[model samples]
Target: MDLELEGKNAIVTGGSKGIGKAIAKELAKEGVNIVIAARNKDLLDATAKELSKETNQRIIPVICDTGNSEAVTKMVNIAIENLNSIDILVNCAARPLVKVLNHFHLKHRMTIFGMI
Candidate 1:
């Protein structure tokens, strides 16, 4: 299918794994230049390398923690600098853990890897 996304640019957060990673891969497959941000530099680098090789598209990895406003700004700047545009924005990253108390018990929920 033609997504008409060739040469488009995108910034995908929490893109090192799970849904974010999947979105980045799909975008790359559709011929989009993508910038993926996560807190783990090593993981980001490895994912970037793997996706770039698989899709034959440019995938830039950035170390970022979206909880920080400065990091978000920096991530955007980096994406624009690398991809030259931000036609798409996929905010797939989320808190890794959430603990809640139910009516009778406690529950632990994981977001991102398990969350996404």
Candidate 2:
């Protein structure tokens, strides 16, 4: 399957690992230039380096938290500047935690990880 993505540009958030990482590797294989974003600078940098070596593709890892709108804006600007135009934008990120409110004490305000 040819995505016709040779020399394309994209941004993959939470790309330091997990699904984001898989997408990046796949895109790189398809010849899509990618900019990976995550909150962890160290992990991002290392992942970028490794991906670059593995697929021999152009991958730039950035420390930008998607939770912050400002960071996302800056990331967009940088992507535009570097890649000129974004042909693809893959925002595959996840929040690692979830809480359920089964019994919330009005005064204490307590919660549980999983509740019915």
Candidate 3:
């Protein structure tokens, strides 16, 4: 189970709960420092504190909304500054266009995914 991930830094988007939380926990178990980002301050703070207590790992909670370009940029910048580098990126964000992502008044649901 040695991922050779000791001292490595990781970024987990939508990491406040569910799948993202599970991923963060696994990474923490591997001795990886985690930067968890979400839009909710309460969720982010609570998750950070809980994870830190469970793993004794450095947990940094970043309040970021992935749908905003500016916020995404800020998250990346701050993560680079804080974690040194993003060795692992766990992108669990769900960008849906079902309600507001329509251009030209088109109706569609978009789940965007890509590497940063």
Clashes of each: 2, 0, 0
Q: Write the per-residue lDDT of candidate 3 for residues 1-116, one digit (tens) a residue.
A: 89899899999999989899999998998999999999889999999999989999998999998989999899989889998899999999776666564552442223243222
Q: What tens-digit string does per-residue lDDT give for candidate 2 at 1-116?
A: 88898898889998999999999999998998889999889999999999999988889887897878998999989888888888888888765543222323432443433343
Runs off by more than 4 Å, candidate 3: 100-116
Q: TM-scores of all models?
A: 0.82, 0.81, 0.83
Across 1-116, the per-residue lDDT of candidate 1 in tens digits comes to: 88999999999999999999999999999999999999989999999999999999999999999989999999999987877779999998886454324511322334323443
Q: After superposition, how far is residue 89 of candidate 2 from its true place, in Å?
A: 1.1
- Please say which candidate is ahead in TM-score: 1 or 3: 3
Best by TM-score: 3
Clashing pairs in model 3, backbone N/Cα/C closer than 3 A: none
* Candidate 3 local lDDT, residue 19: 98
